[model samples]
Target chain A: MQETRLDTARIRAARQVIDPIFLDTPLYRCEALEPVLGCAVSIKLETANPVRSFKARGTELVASLLAGRAAVCASAGNLGQALAWSGRGRGLDVTVVASRFAPAAKLDRIRALDARLELVDGDFDMARERAAAIARSDGIRLVEDSLDIETCEGAATIGLELVDAAPPFDAVLIALGGGALATGVGHVVKTWAPGVEVICVQPLGAPAMTHSWHQRRVVTTDSTDTIADGVAGRRPIPAVLDDLLVVADDAVLVREESIVAGMRMLLDHAGLVVEPSAALGIAAILEDRDRFADRHVATIVCGGNVDMDAYHRWVGARS
Target chain B: MQETRLDTARIRAARQVIDPIFLDTPLYRCEALEPVLGCAVSIKLETANPVRSFKARGTELVASLLAGRAAVCASAGNLGQALAWSGRGRGLDVTVVASRFAPAAKLDRIRALDARLELVDGDFDMARERAAAIARSDGIRLVEDSLDIETCEGAATIGLELVDAAPPFDAVLIALGGGALATGVGHVVKTWAPGVEVICVQPLGAPAMTHSWHQRRVVTTDSTDTIADGVAGRRPIPAVLDDLLVVADDAVLVREESIVAGMRMLLDHAGLVVEPSAALGIAAILEDRDRFADRHVATIVCGGNVDMDAYHRWVGARS
Candidate 1:
C-alpha cells in the first residue's frame, strides 16, 4: 500500500550483509534431468546450506537488523529453524510460534539452535495470531516472513545472484508460500530480465496465494492439506500478494501426486533429496509438460528438510 | 616410480583451468549431523554439479591438456561421465571402458555425454586392461584416473579449496578408490595444513588401497564386492599409492553395513543422497565413534551416482 522499500539497491546491499553460507548457492543446468522433464532445467539449489533451506538468507539479514532485541515469528518449520540459527550467533533471543502439526525434524532443530518454541493447536494462521499476540504483550518485534521489508529484501538477494549467474532462461518457476521467495526473486528477475517469465507454483491442496494472485486480491482458504508444509498456507498476506501480483507473470497449481513424483525424480535423476516444497517447480513441469517442453527453465530448489520416515513414504508410495 | 609431480602449486594452477562448475563446492559444517555422528562434521559436497561427482575437477583439467587428442579411460562410472562431459565440449574423442556391473544410471549418463562406452565382462581390473588395449590399438593416450599426474593434481584443487575455505578440523577422511581424491586432497592438506591428519577410507569389501597404503606397496585382491562401486577397487595403482603413502596419516576400512548406514544417516540428517563411496567418510566415523568423538572432522562427499532401484534397496533395506 505504501511506497515499496524492496529494491535492487537494498537486495545488493543485503548480499554484502547476509551470511556467506546462504550466498553464492549452487546454480547449474540439470542435464541429467532434461530428457525426462522435457525442459532444459537449471536448479538454483538452496538445500546445500547449513539450514538446508533459503530462509537463512532473509533470517540472517533480519537477525542482523534486530541487534539485541527479541524477535518472534510463526513458521511451518524452516523459518523458525532459520531464525533460531541466525539468532543464536548474534545473542538475539527468538521465540517461534509453530503449528502443532509442524514436522518433528524442524522442531528438534529449532530447540537444537536454543530457540524458545511455542506450538498452537490449530493451523498456521492460528500460530501467526499467537505469535502476534506474544510480540504485542512482550514488547518484542514480530518479524513476519513476507510482510517484513527487510526479510523480503534479504530474500531478493537470491534473485540478484540468479540473474547474475544462471544461464539464459525463458521462464523461472518459483515455489510460492507467504511470497517472500517468489516476490523477492520475482522483483529482481522482472527488474533485470524483463522478458523472462516469473511463474509462481503452489500445491493445489493449498492454493491461497495462487487464488489471490489470479484475482488481484487477498484470498483465504478454509484448510491446508498438502504435505509441502513450507508452501502450505491458508491465509494470504495481502502486502506480499500485492508485490507478487506485480512481479508474477503466472501462477500454477500442481497435484499431490506430482509433488511426490517430482521429489523422486530429483533423487533419482539429479541425486538431490528435495523436500515437497522444493519439488514444486518440478511438480509444475510434471503436470504440464507442453508448457516447458524444449524450453530453458530455471527454478530455485528452495529447501530440503523432510523427515526421513515421511520422505520414505512419499518416494516409496509409487514404485 | 618417477619423482611426484602432483603438488599444491600444480593444484593451484589446475583451479584456473578446470571448469568453474566443479571448483569451490559447498564445504560447510553440518550442525544437524554433529550430534548423531559424535563430531563436528564438515561436508565438501561434490554432488551438486553437472557430473554429480568430484571427478569433473580432474577430468576437466585433463581434458584441457588433450585438446585435439583422443583419450581412453576405464571407470566404475563417475570418471567416465566426467570425461565424457568435459570431452564433449572440447571436440576431443573419448572412450570409457567399464564393467557390465557398473550402475545403469552411470552407463546411461556416459552414453548421454556422447562418449564411446566399452563394457567389459569381468571387474574394474578387466575394464582397465581393456581400456589399455584400446589405447594401444588406437594409438590414443590412456588417461588413468589416479596414476595420471594431471588428474591427481586436478583433484588436489579440492584440498586447496578446503584448506582455504573450511573451518579448522582435526582430521579429514576421504574415500579411497584408485586414490585420486584421497591422494590429491591429502597432498594439499598435508603440505599446507601439516597439523591436520589426512586419513583414507575404503570399503572393507575392497581393501586393496588400504592394504597397499599400509604396506607401502601395491596390493591386488582377487575380487571386489561392494555397493560403493565408485570406490570398489581390487587393484591398487602403485603410483597413486606412492603419493598416498607420503601424505596419508592413516588408512581405515569400513564395513559394508556401516557404509549403507552412513548413506542413510547422511540422507536423514544432512539431507544428502550420497552414493556408497561418498558415504565412506561417514561410515568410518560410524564404525569408530571414539576416534572422532568431540573432534572437528571434515570429509569430502565424493560422489552421488547410483541407480534409483539400488538406492531404494540400500536406504530401504534396514528401515
Candidate 2:
C-alpha cells in the first residue's frame, strides 16, 4: 500500500500550501449530541470555510500546483464552489461543467466567484465525462477530484488536526462519496493510531463504495438517488476505492430518512447548519449508538452550502 | 486610563484556563460580505463553541478562578448557558434567574447544561435584581458578567486572536451589550494597533452605552425595546462604560430593521447562523459602508443561539 500520490511527506508538505483559512478549523465535542451517540463526539466543523466544505482544502492544493495553467472540473455542487473560490484568488481560469439539474443557488455562487459554468444536458456522470473531454480538447488541466492523490493529501490536513487535538479516539466516521475524504482521514488515523477504527458512511441509495468494499472491487451503482447530494455517487474511482480498502475498517449505509433527521438534530442540538451529506457521520452514529457507546468518536461536519429554501423545505418537512 | 483587568499579560494568562473549545475560533474574510460592506471584512465566528457564544470564554475564565465554589448568574441568555456549560465540568453549582419573558429555547439549553433555573415573573431587569438578592442571601458567588474584571480579561482572548490574525486593521466593529466583549476585543486591537479605530454597535432602541459614552457617564434608558435582545441594554455598568472609554473610538446605533436585515444578510452571505445581537457588527458596517470604505475591518459573529422559529422569521423575511 505504497501511496505514491499522497505519501507521508507529500501530505505533510501539502499542509504548507493549502488555503490557511481551511486549516485549523474548530474541533470540539457537541455535548448535546454526546448523550444520543453515547460517547464523546468531537466534530471538526469544515462548514466555516469560504466554500463551507472540505473541498476547499483539496481544490486549493490543486490550484497551488497548477503552474498557472487553466483548469476545469465537473461539479454541480461543493467542488465547483471550492474551485471557484480558490482559483479566483490565484488568478487561474476555472470552468465548471455542471449538469442542467445543478441548483441555481450553487450556480449563482460559482458564478459570483468568477468561475465559468458550462451546463451539459445529461446526468452528473455524463457531465463529468464531457468535462474530461473538454479538458483534453482544450489542453486545460482536469480535476479528477476523488482520484487525485494530491487532493487526498490536502484533505489529510483534517486528519492531522483531529489527531493533534485528541489522539486515540476509538473510531472516526467519515462520509463516503468518491472515497477521497474517507481515505484521506482514514490514512492519517491508521498511520498515527493503528488500533483505532476508521468507518465510512454512505447513503443506502448510492452505496457504490460500500458494495465495492464488500465485493472486493470498484463497483458502480445503476442509479444514484439520495437527498445527500454531495455523497451520492453512481460511479466509483478505482484508485480511491483501493485507497479506501487500505485505510478503512468498516462501512455503514444509512437511510435518507435518518439523514434528514440527523440534519435537524445537528441544527437543533449543536447549532450547526450542515447539509445532509455532512450529517452522514452523525446519521451513522445515530443509526447504531450501541456500537459507539462510551467510545471517543471523531467526525467531520464537512459542508454547509445548502440553499436557504431547500434547507427549510428538507428540515421543515421532517419537523 | 490604567487598565487593571484586561492588560495583555492577564489576557494571555486567561487563555490558559478557559475551555480549549472556546479558544482559537475561526477568523477569516467573508468574501460575500465584502461587496456589501465595501471593504475586506474578517469575521471571527464565536458561534462554534458549546454554548454558541463568546460568553463561554469569559464564563470559563471566571469558573477557572472560582475553584469549584458555587456560582450564580442572572441571565435568560448566553451568559447563563456559558456558566452552565463551563461550570458543569468543573463540578460547580450554577443557578440562573430568568425573566418570565425569556426565550424557552435558551432556558432549555441552560437547564440541559445542569444549571438550575429560577423563573421570576417580571422583566429581565427584575430577574437580575432577584439573582443579586439570591446571591446575597444564600452566600453564593455572584458572577456579575460585565462587572467581573476576570471575565473581561477572559473575553480578551478574542482580542488576542484578532490581533494575531489581521493586525493594523483600519476599523473593528464590536457589538456593545454589557460592554465586556467590546472592551475586551477593543483593548487588544487598540493596544496592538493604536491607529486602528474601535467602534461599538448598539441597537437604536437600547442605546444606553452609546449615550453613556457621549455623556461620559453611565446612561439609563426609560424603556429598552429591540429584537437584538442580546445587546438591548436598559442600563450600562459604570466600570464597563469606563472600559469602553479607554478602548473604543466610537459607538454606532443601528435600527432594529437594519439588525433584522443584517441577520438575513449574514446568513445569505456568510453561511453563518448567528443571532440578531451577533449581527450588530455587520449591521454597523451596512449602516454606513461609505465610512468604512477601503478599510480592513474585522467584526465578531459573537453568538448563534437563535431558535429555529426565530431564525426562520429573520432569515425568511428577506428571502
Candidate 3:
C-alpha cells in the first residue's frame, strides 16, 4: 500500500471540492483562556459547521465523489449525521448502521435527513462490520474516515483555512479517533508551518492512536468506554497510523471528567455548544497548561452532537 | 426626537466599524427545511457568533464608540452578556443590570466577562430603570438598545452581509424586543431589496412591539412575561417605533410553547443552540408554513443564551 500524505496540493484540491458545502469555521483568540493557560490560546470552532461538526467536511468530500452512488457508514453519532446530511444534499441514498450506544438525538438527526438507519445490537465496531458487509453486498460506497484518501484530503482543508485565517500558530491540538483528522491536519501544518507543533488528544480509555504512535505499529482494543463517543473507536487504520507517526509531535490522553469540564468551560466562557469529543483538545490543554505557556496555541472543536439527557446529567453533576 | 433609519450610508459606516469586531454570520439556504416548508428558506444564523448572538455586533459597536468609558445596560440575558463581552474586550468598565427573570447561564456569562452585575428585583422594565439611574448618577454611558442609533446601525450590518452573500430574499423574519435588530435590519432590507417583506415576531405575553406597530404608537404594558425573556420588555422606545412604522411590513406574536418547540427544532435539525428570542422567527414560520410556500425567505436567529435548568425543563416537557 502506498503511504498517503496530505500535502498542499491535496489541501487545494479538497478546498475546491469542499468549500461550497463546508463552513470556514472561525479561529478566534480566547483572551480569557489565554491568561489562564499563560498562552495566546485560540479555538478553531468546527462546531459552527452546518452539521455542527468537522465531520461534515470529510463526509461532504466523500459524498461528492460518490455523486451517483449510494453510501454506507457506521457511527456512534456525529459521523453518521454528517454523512446523512451530505449524502442527502448530493441526492445519494445513505444507510447508517449505528450502535445502540449512539445518542438518540444523533439518531433523530440521521432520520430527519431521510437516511436509512440500521440499529446494531453490539458496539461501534460491530456496527462498522455490518455497514461494511452491507456496502459490499449492495455495491454501495463505503466512506471510511481513516482508510479513505478523499476523507484525509477533505479534513486537511481545516489546516488550509486556519493558515489563511490567522498567523502561524505555535501548536495545534486535535482530537484523535481513527487518526484521519490528526494525520491530515498535522501533515498540512508541518508542511505549511514547519515550526508548529501538532498534538493529538485521545480519551484515556480509548488510546489506540496514542499506543500505536508510541509502539510504531497499528493497535486495537477489545473494549473502550468514554464520554467522547465520537472519538471512542479502538482500531486505527494502518495508512492513518503511518502518516500520524511521521507528522504528530506528541499525544495526550485526557480523562473523561476533564472532557466534560472542557465542554462546560466552552459553554460558559466562549458561549459554544460542543460535545465531549469536540472538547478533547481543550481538555488536554486544561490538563497541562504549562506546556502551552507563552505560545500561540490552537485547538479544534471537532463536533457538537451531545445527547440531551446525558448533557443534562453532566451539567447537573457538575453543579 | 428624530427617527433613526439606518440608511445605506449609515449601514456602510456601521459595516466598516463592525466588520473587524463581529463575525459576518453566514446566510445559507436550509435545504432540509426548504422541502418541509415548500420554499427556499434561508437562515441567517447569528448563533454562530463568538458571543453566540447578533447582539454582539451592536454591543461591540457601542463599546468601541464608548472608548474606555464606563457603560451600563439592562437585559433579560443576551444583550447584557454581549455588552459585557464587548466592553471587556475594549477595556471598558461595564455594569449589567439584569432582572431576576433573566437566565442564570446568561448572568454567568456576563460575570465571566468581568462585568459588574446588579440583579434587580422585578422584571426587565425595573432593571432598565435601575440601569438608567446608575448611568445618570455615575456619569456612565447608557447603552440602551432602541434609542442608540449606533446600536441600530451596527445591527443593520446583518442585512448588508446577507444581501452580499445571497440572492434577493422575498421576506425576512426578525425577533423583536427593544426593536433595534428588527428596525435596523428592516431599514436596510427595504432600502436595498425593496420587494422584501420584513416581519417582526414577538412573544404573545410581551407583545409591546406588536401592539405599538398596530396602534401606531409606542405602547407600554403593566407587566410582561414570557420564555423569550430577551424580547419581553413592556415599553417600546420612540426611535424603534418610528423605524418600525416606516420599514416593517407586519408583526406576529408567537405562543410560548411554540418558541420552546422552535428552539428544539433548531437544536435537533440544525444542531444549533438558540435562545427563545432567536426561536420566535422560526416559530412564526412553523405556524404559517403556507405563507412561505415556494418563496425565498430568510429568518434571523437572534441569540443563544438559555439556562441549562430552563432548557432541561423545556426538553422534559416535550418528552
- Best-matching candidate per DockQ: 1
Expressed as tens digits, the lDDT of each residue in B1-319 for candidate 3 is: 1244666686787766664536566566665555555777677878655566788888878888886789999888777888888888788899999997688878877888899999999999899999999999998888888778877877888888766655688889999998888888888877778688999999999998899999998889989878888889898888779888888999999898888877877665565667889888778888888888778888898887777557657745322
For residue A33, model 2's alpha carbon misses the true position, in angstroms, by 2.9
Judge candidate 1 against the unseen true structure and give its global Cα lDDT, from 0 to 1.
0.89
Worst 10 residues of 3 chain A by lDDT: A310-319
lDDT of 1 by residue, A1-319 (tens): 2234477788888988888988888889899888889889999999998889999999998899897889999988999999999999887899999988988988889989999999999888889999999999999999898999877887888888778764678989999999999999999988888888899999999999999999999989899989999988899988898899888899999999999999988887898988899999999999999999989999899999888788877887322
Model 2 lDDT, full chain set:
0.83
TM-score of chain A of each: 0.97, 0.96, 0.95
- Candidate 2 residues lying further than 4 Å off, grouped into runs, are A1-5, A35-39, A317-319, B1-5, B317-319
**Cα deviation in Å at residue B258, candidate 3?**
2.7
Model 2, A1-319: lDDT tens digits are: 4452357777888888886889889988788788677888888899887778899888888888784679999885788889888888887799998877766667777988989998988766877898999999999999977787766887888888877765468888898888779888889878877787999999998898899987879788788888787877788888788888888899989999889888888887787778889899889988998899988888899888777777767778321
lDDT of 2 by residue, B40-110 (tens): 88888999877888998888887777767898888848899999888888878999988766666778889
Lowest lDDT 10-mer window, candidate 1 chain B?
B1-10
Q: Rank the candidates by DockQ, best first.
A: 1, 2, 3
Docking class of 2: acceptable
Docking class of 1: medium
Poorest 10 consecutive residues by lDDT, candidate 3 chain B: B310-319
TM-score of each: 0.97, 0.94, 0.86
